[model samples]
Target chain A: MTIRKTASDYSRSHEPIVWGLFSAGGVIVAFFIPALILLTSLLVQVGIADEAVLSFDRVQSFAQAWWGKLFILAVIALSLYHTVHRIHHGLHDVHIHIPDSLAIIIFYGGATVLSCLVFVWLLAIGW
Target chain B: MSTSEKTIYRKPYVQNQSASWWLKNKFYIWYMVREGTAIFVFLYALILMLGLLRLAQGEAAWNAWVASLSNPAYIVFHGIALIAAMYHVHTFFKMFPKVIVIRFGNWKMPESYLIAGQWVGFVVCTAVILGIGLFVGV
Candidate 1:
């Protein structure tokens, strides 16, 4: 027997909002994160990539550009939500009991605060 | 509402589980490892934020930040993070079809197709970023 959920039932839960961000962020991580790690850290260090790939002036100019700022913000903010959401649920799998409200505040709220900070820093970086 | 007449509700018993329960099963161990990638991702994000903070300070500060990444410890850390991120990509693509379904009329798109398309997208994205990093700068 199918027990259909009403619109009101959906609205009462935060699952949709958080799950949306989680999946979106997961896609971003899968597509972009490995490359980011390679570009920003590993390849250059190993001498397989040029040092100018992440030279101070190059990265600085990138951060100062509008699209570049948006890119940085999206990558950082979404990845934060993606990881924290997993960490929150992963805690439960490990039998650690955190009260729902408190967990939401700590994980989701913390992601939001950090995302805001990224946005602020991007703005501070200027165009 | 006299204190003697008030009834207290009893809670149901829940079986206690040790935090290391995942260690007992190979499948559970892999599951934990997959979830564990989040910690690496989170730490890397913090590192990027720190880089951004330093970038905002000045050229001297930014150069200092770049120099710091060359430290042996940070190189090791990034190596681990790079592996963790690749693992995340693998697990994410494996799980994506279950999360989102697509159908056209009577025929449904195969999960293999979805996974393959995602890989193509991932390769394209990686190439674009590599191009930008390698070619966009002076």
Candidate 2:
């Protein structure tokens, strides 16, 4: 007897999982990043924001807290996933051809590794 | 290998596109610009990661990291990043209404309201972050 394979035999795509993270990251970026950029960079340059606002003692204490660690991890990890997903697909827009599998491994894998590093670093900071 | 076990392959022709294809039209250019914002976002995240690493190193290292931001080049980069992030916000908010569908039973929420609500959320988030940084001491 001969067997036939239909579309259902194929495994599902992982696009949805990454796309969901990308959307969440987009919302985070839209709502939080401008103000963060202002606080970290432009305000400091123009002397409107005191450099001490980000002093080691204050920032360290904040980051050492459970909430602060969660907040930082969420922002960095989500943003990494969002941006790397964009950059991965953007390669095609510019006509830079690479195996899609390789691109996925490189971009998504890198984001995962970096996020893990951030989590580890946050723990090292301690409460 | 047996000849009957060999697989035959077919090659299909794909249209060749230039690397600068996006530069051909204004709309495409803007789309590319929107996508390009990812680079800035990625870099800023790296800066934060470096800051985190420095923070773990100790107060002196953290101070040095903060002081490094005072560089003229760093300021310029941040300025560009700020603009890019805002543009991202604009584009993202505009796209949100289409991406998410909301309705009240039979009554669907208008796109305008959805977009406006996002702006409200944005304002609230910005306020909270800035308020903490300014009044709460980081």
Candidate 3:
């Protein structure tokens, strides 16, 4: 006869993996934000036509371009995950009992949906 | 006790708390935010590389890539990303004063002032780039 492990046992086994993924994802997004800002600023200076700088026209062109949109999406998605994870942990630090699993699902899930929508909108504009 | 044992001996001890106790402390939330943002920066780098690749491929390929990004799903995704990125930046700038610790002679600079300076710098840089773009016209 075999003994079955309870939910606690499963959680104990999986907790580290979940935390690790959350941490890695958080770190990736955190680092991407500043870098993207810098890169975009530089790109605007060097790559785009002079008139496009700071204007919606430039933003439109960049947003519409495949490479540009992807770059923007990656930055947003990763950062969103990172921000949510950090906020979750931050709340936990303050003795808030916000369930870790639920927080992860909501924050990361929300980020995914938002990123997808933005990418679609940019594409639709025919940029 | 031998001569070598003459010196006072202290009892060995082990920490009772978990390894993450320091991070779990409420006061350290800001530090965590800073660290979290650092991770996002790395992800952005990869995105940049992809963009460069698309740029190198020439107009048709690049346009095709751009067209694909128009899907509604992607637009929503980017919108969330933008918010996340803004949060990261705001937090990073807020923490800048603490992390850098700049002292002017005997007096230390205020963190608020440092944060304000950073925001100003960001605005100036953005303005400069925009100005250049307007002058050149793509």
Model 1 alpha-carbon drift over 4 Å, by segment: A1-11, B1-17
lDDT of 2 by residue, B1-138 (tens): 556975658778898887988889999999999999999999999998999999999999999999998999999999999999999998998898897889889998898998899889989999999899777955
TM-score of each candidate structure, all chains considered together: 0.88, 0.89, 0.43
lDDT of 1 by residue, A37-115 (tens): 9888888888988777777778878998889998999999999999999999999998889999999999999999999
Name the candidate, 1 or 3, with the larger DockQ value. 1
lDDT of 3 by residue, A19-61 (tens): 5555445434434443345334333334443323444455556
Shift of residue B74 alpha carbon in model 2, Å: 0.6
Give the DockQ (C-alpha) for candidate 1.
0.70
What clash pairs does model 1 have? none
Full-model lDDT, candidate 2: 0.90
Best by DockQ: 2
Q: List the lowest-lDDT window of 10 residues for candidate 3 chain B.
A: B38-47
B1-138 in candidate 1: lDDT tens per residue?
556965679888998878888999999999999999999999999899999988888789988888889999999999999999999999899899987899989998899999999999999999999888878754
Which candidate has the highest TM-score of all?
2
Rank by DockQ (best first): 2, 1, 3
lDDT of each: 0.90, 0.90, 0.54
Each model's chain A TM-score = 0.89, 0.89, 0.62
Worst 10 residues of 2 chain B by lDDT: B1-10
TM-score of chain B of each: 0.86, 0.84, 0.64
Q: List ranges where model 2 is wrong by over 4 Å.
A: A1-11, B1-16
